[model samples]
Target: MQDMKIADLPVHDRAIDITGETCPMTFVRTRLALDSLPDGAVLLVRLKGADPRANVPRAAADQGHDLLDMFDLDDGSAILVIRKAGA
Candidate 1:
């Protein structure tokens, strides 16, 4: 795949790696991770497959978080950079 990640982005406040996790767990972990952050805090979430690539971002947006970027890495996984919406 083409390298489309943004070169300069906001520094993430935290990171969660859910590569081996599945649907509900993927989202659950993401939600919990976001909850730990204060407003405007950025999080870097590492996940894999089409499901996570699809669901996580949508769920984050629905919950009012900012989905800053989604990048597909050479490892066949992806990175979702999200900023917590409120304190």
Candidate 2:
């Protein structure tokens, strides 16, 4: 198997923007969204700032989800791709 580029990933099952959110709220919102998803669903999280850029993916992975990818957008924010853990 080969690693897919961020652009090659399938369309996300859901997407949320947390560019206006900070720290714990960033992960909080992300967790809430993940909780709403079915097992193995993919989520696209749009976030800004160093805190969220670093924390959301780490926290999601810690909670047993898969961190597919994290990459920057041209506008300065970044996108985090996560796959919900199978139940």
* Highest-lDDT candidate: 2
- What tens-digit string does per-residue lDDT give for candidate 2 at 1-87? 144365664589998999999899999999999999999999999899999998998999999999988877767888899999994
lDDT of 1 by residue, 1-87 (tens): 455454443477888899999998999999999998889999999899889899999999999998998877778988899989984
Q: Which pairs of residues collide in candidate 2?
A: none
**lDDT measured at residue 26 in model 1 versus the true structure, 0 to 100:** 97
Question: Which segments of model 1 are wrong by more than 4 Å?
Answer: 1-10
Error of 2 at 35 (Å): 0.3
